[model samples]
Target: MTNGSPSESAISPGKPGQSTAVHVRDVTMDFGNGALAVSNASFELETGKFLTILGPSGSGKTTLLRMIAGFETPTSGEITVNGKPVDSAPPHRRSIGMVFQKLALFPHMTAAENIAFPLKMRRFNPKTIPGRVDEFLDLVKLGGYGNRRINELSGGQQQRVAIARALVFKPELLLLDEPLAALDVKLREEMQLEFRRIQHELGVTTINVTHDQREALVVSDDIIVMDGGRIQQHAKPVDLYRAPDNAFVAGFLGVASFINGHAVPGGLASGENFLSGTHAGDFADGTAVRGAVRAEQIRIAAEGGQLTACDTRLTGTVRDTIFEGERQLYVVATEEIPGITFRIYHHDPESFGLFEIGTRVMIGWNARDMKIFESRAS
Candidate 1:
C-alpha cells in the first residue's frame, strides 16, 4: 500500500450552533496482529453538503463510515459531530440516520409501519406519528404505500421505505453504506438521483460510502478517494476526475491509459516520440515518469487527416475495436511504444468511420488533457 497524506485537517470547532457537520481528525484503526484498516484519515464536512467516500473493497471506506456512525471506535484520533466528541458515544445517542447495503426492513411490517418505527423508538408524540409517517412517505414519494407489506413492494419501493425510515426521525447526520449496491444498474442510477433530490430537499449533511465510481460522481458535492488504508485525494467530482493527485486516483476514477517514459523539460519521451502533457508534481529532467491520458480525450482519424490543433500526435494500427451503443472503443498499437496499446474512444461513431482491426490511423490529443506523474502501478 502506498502512503498518503491526509487531504485536510478538521475545521476548528465553531461557536454554539455553528459547528461543522462532521470532523474527523487523524483517525486510525488497527486490528490485532498488524491489521491496519485506516491510517491518519482526516476531513471536514460542512452542513447540508453531500460527501462520498469512494474506493475499492477492503479500502477502509466502510470502516471509516462505521466509525462515524459510532458502530466502532477509532483506535486513535478524534471524531466530532456538531462540535461534540463522539468516540465514546453509543450509536443510538449519536443522532445519526443510517441506510445500510441491505434494506434491513422488517419483513412483516407495512411500508408506513417501517417508516414510523424510528419515530416510535425515539418516543415521538404518539398523536403525531401518523401525520409524520404521511409526511415522510411524501418526502420519499411513497405516499399511500403505508398499507402495503414489505414483500408486496418492488425493490425500488422497498429502498424508498428504508430511506424514509432513516429520515423520519430527523437525525442531524445521515450515513449511507452502499445502499444502492444491490439494485440493478438502471434502478441504481435512478436512486442516485433520488438521493440527491431528497438530500437537497431536506438539507441534510450526509456521508456515503461506495465502490461504484458513477454513483459517487452522480450524487456527491465532494468526493474522498481512499485506498490501502489512506486518504488519497479529496475534491469535487470534476476536479477528482480531471486533476487526480496521483496515479492510483487517476486509474481508479476513469478509463485512463498510461505510457511509461522519462521526464523531459515539460513532458515525457518514449523512444523517438516526445509527448507533451501537463503536470503539477516535481519531476527532474531524466527522471522516470509516466504520462496519463483519459481514453475519451484522444481523437483518432485516418492517415493524413488534419490534426493541426492537437499538441501530441501519433500514428498507430487499430489492433481492436469495441462497439458500445453510444461510442466505439479502439485499441491502437503504436510504433513509438513497442509493447503498449493506446485505448481511444470515439463518441460519434455514426459520424466517423470505424477503424477496423489492422487499419492504420492517427491519434491525437491536447497536452492539457494528459497528465504526467511518477511511474508506478496504479
Candidate 2:
C-alpha cells in the first residue's frame, strides 16, 4: 500500500524462499585473449538473502557484479534469474536495480523528481507519481525533504535518495557496488548499518561487492572470499573467521604466525621443542608441516615453569613490545626456535600486562588452537 508520500512505501520487496534469485554457473570472463578477469566463478544467490563478494583489489569482484547487472556478459556458462535464462536479456528487461559507487543523482532535480525519474521512464501514470515519490521518501526517512535540491541534502541523505530512486521501479534484485565507499569512515559505517536495516526490512535479494572484510562480515548473511579471481571460501562470517580453510585464508582474515615443525611420535617437533596436538591433514610420521596460530591464541608465561604437561611451550626473549590502549602486543624471539617470532596479545594484567621487552618468557598454546597446513615445497 502507498504511504502518505509516494516514497513512504518504497520498501525493498520481501525476500523469496529457498528458491534461487540469481545463479552463476561456471562463468568466466576474459578480455580479448589476455588474462581472465573472472575464472570459472560460480555461486547461487538465495531470494531475500544478502551475499557479498569480498576480496582484495583486482580480484574481479566488480567484473562479476557487472555481469550480474547485465552490464557485462560472461564469456562462457549461463546466468539465470528466477529460473529463467538471462544471459541474452538486456539490463532494463532483466528487472534489476543498481547503485554505483557514485550516487549518480541528477544535480538539477529535486529529491522528489529524482525519485520519480525511474517511474516516469516506466510510463507510470503522471497522476500517481507524486504519491509514489512521497511513499518512498518516507520509507527512506526523507519524507518531508522531497522538495530539497540534490545539492541541499547531506551525503547520507543523498544516498538514501539514490536508494529510493532505484527501488521506485521495484526491481526483483538489487546490486550495490561499494555504494558507501566514497563516504567518510564514520559515515560509511553508519550507512552500512542503515543499508542492512533497510535490506532486512524489505527482504529483497541483494549482491554487494566490497574489498573491506569488516564491511562484508557486518552486512552479509553469507560471504564469498575471493583471491586471484577465484573464490577461496564461501561461508558464514563466524565460520570463515574461526576456521579458515588454508594458510592464505587464515593470514588474509587477520594477523597470524606460521611455525614449521616435524611430526613426531607424540606430536609435532620443531628443533628442540615439541608441541602436542591432533594433526589436521594427511601427513606421515616425521613429515614436516606448518602450524599457524592467531596472535590472541598465544599465551605468555613467566619463565621457570616445571615443564608441566601442557599442549606446547617454548622459552623466548621479549624482542619488542607495543602497548595498544586496551591490549599489549609482544614480539618474542625464542631460543628453541631462532629467527621465528611469536606475537602474543595481552589484555588482562594477570596475563599480558606483566611482560616487558628484554624479559625472558615462555610462550605456549593448546594444540587445538593451532592450525596445521600441509607445507608446500619451494
Candidate 3:
C-alpha cells in the first residue's frame, strides 16, 4: 500500500457499482438576506474526469465547488460521491483531497514530511508511510526535494508539494481551488500542464474552480461557466469557445466586440450597414439584437479594397493602434455602427503597417464568424 499505488477499493470508495464519480442534483446555496449564491445547479462528473468551474468574482464558482467538497452544505437538493449521498457528510468523512490557493504546506515540515502528514492523519499503516512519501515525491517530479523546507523551494515546487500531499492519501476525488492563481503568468501556465500530467497519471476525478478563463480552457475536460449564481453554459473547451450559448459566454471567453442593431432576415442591421451573421431565437423582423465578433475574426485591409467574397464589409478610420509584440490591436471607429468600435487583431504586421491614427481601413468578416444574440435592453 505504501508504493504510491492506491487500493482498488479506496480509488472507488463507497459504491462499487457506480460509474459516476460525483453527482450534484438541483443544488442551491443561500447566504441570507434573500441572496442566492448558487441557483439550481446540477451536473455529473464521470469517473476520472477533470471538471473546472469558471466565473468572475462573486459568481458562485467557489460556492459550488465547496458544496461538492463537503465544506458547505446546500440549502436545497443533494450531492452524491461515488453513488453514495454525501450531503450530510463532513469534509474529512468524504473520500476527497483538496489543494487550496495558498498551497498550505507547513513551513516547519520538509517536503516529505508535508506529504506524510496526510497519510498519518488518515491512519495509514505507520510502517508503510516512508515508502508512500517517497512514491508521492517522485510522482510530483520532486524525487530529490523531500528534505527541502517549504520556504526553500520555488513557488512551482511548493505547488508540487501541496499536490503530492493531497494525492499521497489516494483519495477517490481531488478538488483544486485556484491553486495556480498566485504564480506568474509563465509559471501558472506551466503548472497547468503539470496538473494535467499528474491527473492523467493517477486517473483521479478532479473539480477545480478558478476565475481565469484561459486556465479553465487549458486544464479542464469540461468547463462549467457560472454567473450571478446560475449556470450559463457547460461544454468541452473547444465546443464552448466555438459555439457559445449566449452573449455572456461569448464575451467572457475572449476579446469580443458587440454591435447593437435590429435583426433582419440573415443578420442584424445598423442603419444602411447590414452586418451579415448567423443568428438564433424566434424574434420577428426588426427585433433588437446584438452581433458579437471576436477581435481575430475580422480581416483588416488598407483603404476599401475589393472584398467581394466577405459576407460583411465596412470602412472605418483607425482611431487607435496598440503594438503587442506578435500581434497588433487596431481600434476602428466607424460611422456605419455608431457607438460601437470594431477591434481587429492583425497578426502580420509586415503585410499591414501599423495604420496611422487617422488612416482609413477596410474590414470584413464571414457571416458565420459573427454570433448574434437577442438584446434584452428595453
| Superior candidate under TM-score, 1 versus 3 | 3
Comparing 2 with 3 on lDDT, the higher-scoring candidate is 3
TM values, all candidates: 0.93, 0.86, 0.94
Per-residue lDDT of model 3, residues 107-206, tens digit only: 9999999999988888989998998888788888999999998899999999999999999888888999999989999999999999998887777889
Candidate 2's TM-score reads 0.86
Cα RMSD to the true fold for all candidates: 7.0, 3.4, 2.3
Q: Which stretches of candidate 3 lie over 4 Å from their true place?
A: 2-10, 13-18
Lowest summed lDDT window (length 10), candidate 2: 5-14
| lDDT-based ranking | 3, 1, 2
C-alpha lDDT of residue 89 in model 2: 75
After the best TM-score superposition of candidate 3, give how far the Cα of residue 229 lies from its true spot, in angstroms.
0.9
Better of 2 and 3 by TM-score: 3
Give the alpha carbon lDDT tens digit for every residue of 147-193 in model 2: 99999999999999988887777777888998888898898898888
Alpha-carbon runs more than 4 Å astray in model 2: 1-15, 32-34, 260-272, 276-289, 305-310, 348-354, 375-378
